[model samples]
Target: MKKIWQLGFLLTMAFVLLVGCNQSETQKLSTGKSEKTTQTTDKTATYPMTVKDALGNEVEFKEEPKKIVSLIPSNTEILFALGLDDKIVGVSDNDDYPKAATKKEKVGDMEFNVEKVLSLKPDVVFAHESSAKMVESGLQQLKDAGITVFVVKNAASFEETYDTIKQLGQITNQPQKADQIVAGMKVKVKEVQDKVANVKQRTAFVETSGEPEIYTAGKGTFMQEIFDLANIKNVVDDQSGWFKIDPEQIVKRNPDTIIVMEDEKYFPNIVEKVKQRQGFDSITAVKNNAVVKVDQNLTARTGPRLAEGLEEVAKAVYPEAFK
Candidate 1:
């Protein structure tokens, strides 16, 4: 599958660079010193992220990994958020956020250039389950060569995501900092939930992509899950993953609320375009001001800022609940 290759390219490119960090041990500063963290605002974030990689070897970095590499886009975002941006030496070719991320080097897409990753010499590499097999195949040799690696469970739910974030804090030796970040996120999540918990059920459609007319993200995806969290009913809850779709089906569905994750550069215009489609004129979302635009990066990727993304989804799906 194209996505599998894409997944491979993104993950490997992300993994190689971070794990390439020099094995030369760095002295651990006594208990209160902060590791490399992002300087934006005073928001401190840290986390533990050690666990066996798919290769069956234990990996750990004692003093906050000074040179880090993030294979997953979501993990890349989390690293940045945890005030660990400076430590990140390389990122997946797809990791884009905080605008500044674009300035960093990209190893390659899914089937990232392993050679390039080896050169960066990262202190640690962050990876997850989706690419575990590929990561294992590629890194087993690298492990024999002696590189510390860790595998993070790519969590499905928001709660699991929180736990993962906390885990990241602990592994990175910034438990207190990481806890503070999660605490702040919890406040925002609860705020969003409280705002929409009592709203009426809104039928929403989350657009995935289109070519042979593909559309997906139903009952199991993080997108649909977010809707359920907001108490909104997904019109395509029966579908699984992202699938091929047509406007005719959408028009017939006539969902009450519509959520579009992709547009021309995250613009709100797609909502209007979907509304203009044939038959959709009769749909409630098009008739009312129920059409909402969501940024793909914010909603689609499972990461630390996911709570913020959920808040956006919740607000779009249920405005009255928030107000």
Candidate 2:
């Protein structure tokens, strides 16, 4: 009787042990599955990037930055457009975009006070390659102390401007958004071109940077790109992009129209002033009263509003045809 009872107890204990073991195995399988899912998610989060600048500098961008500092006025505008204004830690004194940029703490004047920039402790600093010699060394010193400084090429033409915006969008992890903005601009520019496609082309001169001898806007400039779409001949050889031309050069080219880079403060009454210049009556632009005024800001800068700038140029060049 005693042996039978002992055997029965042993059997009951064996059953309990088996039940616990099964529960433990089930939990182990569930935990393993959770780990596998986590690893798969992490594996696909690849975001290393590379880019090139106008100065032929190959830039390798590897991480998403939380804090950025811009050293140029144009860069400030671009940064805000890329949805980085909130992350921007510092800006140049002249940054006036999004209106909020005006209130941010300024590191320093565009090319002044390197120490102020270092004090901001920016994760990344954006500068112009053209001014690299003036500021790149200071930036490198900050880089050596574990900072990242990036230089963007200054774009002189419309295509380069588009490329710069596209590249910046990638850096900010907003490539799709950047392309959308650029695509809209291309559409607007094309509309103007298609309108003037059949218009009678005209010869012209575009003066840039007010001067004693007119320094005209020519090829490789935003003004020239607009002029091309307007189907106007830039009388001064666009060979050197821009050069000084006297009244004789103007009459010799015999441009049908002349457009001055106007400053409201300086050339308030351009029509009367242009009429009084010596030997000006012989020129077609002066004779037909085809002289027009254009804002210096719209004609020069590369910004989101450039499409509107192109519109102003196209209309000024061929008012009747565009209408």
Candidate 3:
């Protein structure tokens, strides 16, 4: 009777161990499935997606693009910032940033080469809203060839720029990277704003060109928005858009500082040229030696470096505040 009882006890112990081993294996499989589900949910976009462009045309992507062509420098810069450099097969002739972009196959400047772009067999091509009308025929040709073309909006404000980045991120399946870039931009902008918050506001005049035809950024322009954010007043705020301003008119405005965006390669000694202009010596900026030169690309291009442009402008205008 005692031997039979011991045998029964051993059998029960073996059965309990076997049940515990099966439960452990089942839990492991369940955890792995849950992890895969989370990964799928984290993706910003899925395959066979459709998106609307600035021209109100819908373009569909069967899958994430493996090859891309950017027709504008700004779009190329944004793409590079999103870690899509490896995917870029062609770029505009004017794309000079990121160093590597300069080595890409050129598809022409303002007028892109449809044949060249077609030869690349890109999965998608990025166009800009500013040149949409000018390149309407080329874009249509691309569409007729069954190539996907997305017209990015001409971003005029930081918020609009952020939207562009986010849209591209979703389109390229780099939504997380796009969000991180935008967050960093916002932080930099806020830091500059906070730095100048206690500083006294000063009036400024921004010159985009000089000599034969002088031009300045006025109201309804991106530079005006930058000026506002930097806590600096635009002397030409009364005017709208980029318009020619007489040297005499600048004299009359008597701005506290002057910012020039002309490249030295095209306009050498531009700062001194501004100071030596007839009757400019009497201006406050010229007298105080406050004429500053900033990179045209940084100030003009609507890309990832726009916040850097703002910081450069703010620092140039208010050096004391930054110190």
Q: At residue 168, what lDDT does model 1 achieve?
A: 67
User: Taking the candidates one at a time, how many backbone clashes does each contain?
Assistant: 34, 0, 0
Higher-ranked by lDDT: 2 or 3: 3
Per-model TM-score on C-alpha atoms: 0.78, 0.74, 0.86
- Per-residue accuracy of model 1 over 1-323 as CA lDDT, tens digit each: 54444433333433342222212111122223453433222233233323343344445455567787777787777777778867788887777786667778787665566666678887777776667676666555444556556776656566656666656665565556666777888898788877877666678887744333445566556666677767788888876645557888888888888777654543346667777777878988888978787776676566767778888888787776666
Per-residue lDDT tens digits of candidate 2, residues 199-296?
Answer: 78888787653446466644544456567766878875445445556767776787788887655455567656776777788888888888878764
lDDT of 1: 0.64
Q: Which digits, one per residue and each the tens of the lDDT, describe model 3 over residues 1-323?
A: 33232223222322322222111000001121232211211236766666667677766777899999999878999999999989999999878999999999999867789999999999999998777777899999999999999998777577777777877877898989888888899999999999999888999998877777687877767777789999999999997767778999999999999999766766799999999999999899999999999886786667899999999999889988878
Q: What TM-score would candidate 1 get against the native?
A: 0.78
lDDT, each prediction: 0.64, 0.63, 0.79
RMSD (CA, angstroms), candidate 3: 22.3
Candidate 1 at 240: error in angstroms? 4.0
Which pairs clash in model 3? Answer: none
lDDT of 3: 0.79
Query: Ten-residue segment with the worst summed lDDT in candidate 3?
Result: 21-30
After superposition on all C-alphas, the RMSD of every candidate to the true structure, in Å, is 8.2, 24.9, 22.3
